[model samples]
Target: MRPTRRRATVQHTPAQQMLGAAEAMLRHALASGIVVPEAVVETVELACTHRRAGGEGELEPPTPALLRRLARAHAELVRLVAPATPRTILLLSHGRRSRLAMLGPVRLVRQMLVAVLVLLAAFVALSTTDYVNGTGGDILNSTGLSLLVNELFFLAAGGLGAAFSALFTAYRYIAEGTYDPKFESSYWLRFILGLMAGLLLPALVPLGADAEAEGISRPLLALLGGFSASVLYRILERLVGAVESLVRADSRELRAARRAADLAQASDRARLERLELVGHLRRLEQQARAGGTPDQLAEDLGRMVGTLLPVAPQDADDASDEHPQPLISPPAR
Candidate 1:
């Protein structure tokens, strides 16, 4: 008779499986040259030792404490290696939060559709009502309510315009694969700006001037203003520039006139000084013709020199040292 044969089955416990997975991750990190710390590697190796200590068929399950340590080691290893991993895989492994980010583009498109539908429904409701024609007696009974309703109509049109722009923008971003949740806030801010543009454009500008003649209505103009808020902003900027230019032109003319007046004053002052100098010269000539003495002539000439070139206090001593020299050689008299 042939010898009997023995069959052995192998089973891996949870702790062993976890330890194996950690070791596998560590090996991959080392192979990829990810620079994991030695402490982390030692911790992972120590956890792996427990599985190897029990030889084949021994089935020595790890205690809860050992399992926890093993789990921590595995977590650390994954953390070290995650940065080198691709984003798509990281998103998948990280659970719902990351997956939700992946859905941002879709969510934005849905929101755009919903907003458009809401605006359409509001427009339909307004069109079917007598408020559109201003013929509903009870609805228009209160003047305040009438004004409020008109404002609401303009807001709705503005909202519709904003919705249209947001839909197109979201679609463009989605196609480019660069969509992000941060862009949602920008879309909302644009909507608010559009609403303000719609309400303020007609009031600040004369949009209703040719409404009756050109067959255009106030709400239609508001819609256009909201749709092209940038255009309205450009127009307002140009108006401000024109007003500033006008003010500056007036200021420039005033400055020119002031400068001319200053020049005239300076000219008059110079003429008066020249007249005074001429009078002094005439007196000196009269003295000379009257046969004035050398001493008197020297005194008059020194006085004239002192008046024309006044010396500073510090230079007065220097001027005195040179006083012995005759100023004009006694005029050769």
Candidate 2:
């Protein structure tokens, strides 16, 4: 048998951990070309330097104020350069439970959203039970549950699909470490889209002889449409495109206008780039011409040549002769 190895258990004091975190943050800031604040410098100094007191050499422990300043600086730099940096670093640097405690509210809100979605799904399931079993009574009577239950049934199914989609999205982002509280509103929008898709799909794509033969139901189609709203959206987009295609003259005019705008934008961008190149050439020309190293001379010469060369135009219209290509094609009869 191979020799059994024991894992080393190395524990760090709070001060040492804070110092390490500070050092790590400062190193990250330096690597990212961010400015290190004075507080971080002080914290580093206090943590590293030993002072002689009572003839004993001991590190000048970092003060609370210094640590607080360091924490703020670290947080600011982390937010600017790498927002996805784990909260454990902040917790370590701050030496406080409250650093992670702030996320409690966000967690609670997500849980509440998930709970509401679950309830909605359960309610929808119960509401459709009789209908699915082919023992349905009047689905559109005057009672509160039946006033518009026929439409509400499909809409709720769609909402349930949206909820599942949202949950899946949240799971993906959380697993990938890219979840942010700021994008919660987008999930709400998705839910609304799901509801719309759920309601509209039944009307747009009817289940006739083929669907009955295949055992497809209207509500089931609505749920599927809600679950894949993007596909439903593409279907609607294609319908709109086909309608637009029927009016060839109007479509051609729209295309021409869009092309003209794009060409104008390209022309403006090219003019700005040329001006910038001219400015760079002028600055390089103004720099000292004497006693420069060979590497510096070569770099300057290369830049000058690069700035002076004629750049190929990005647009075909810009590169072609003065008689430009027609922006619009003749509308087909």
- Per-model TM against the reference: 0.43, 0.43
| Candidate 2 overall lDDT versus native | 0.63
Clash count in backbone of candidate 2: 0
Q: Estimate the overall C-alpha local distance difference test score of candidate 1.
A: 0.68
Worst 10 residues of 2 by lDDT: 133-142
- Give one digit per residue, the lDDT tens place, for model 1 in 71-123: 88878876876643322222223323444454332656566677777877876
Q: Can you give the lDDT of residue 236 in candidate 1?
A: 88
Model 2 stretches with alpha carbons more than 4 Å out: 1-83, 86-147, 247-333
For 149-260, candidate 2 gives per-residue lDDT tens digits of: 5466778777777767877776666544356666878877887888898877866774555775687776776688777788688889999999878866586788999999
lDDT (Cα, 0-100) at 197 in candidate 2: 88
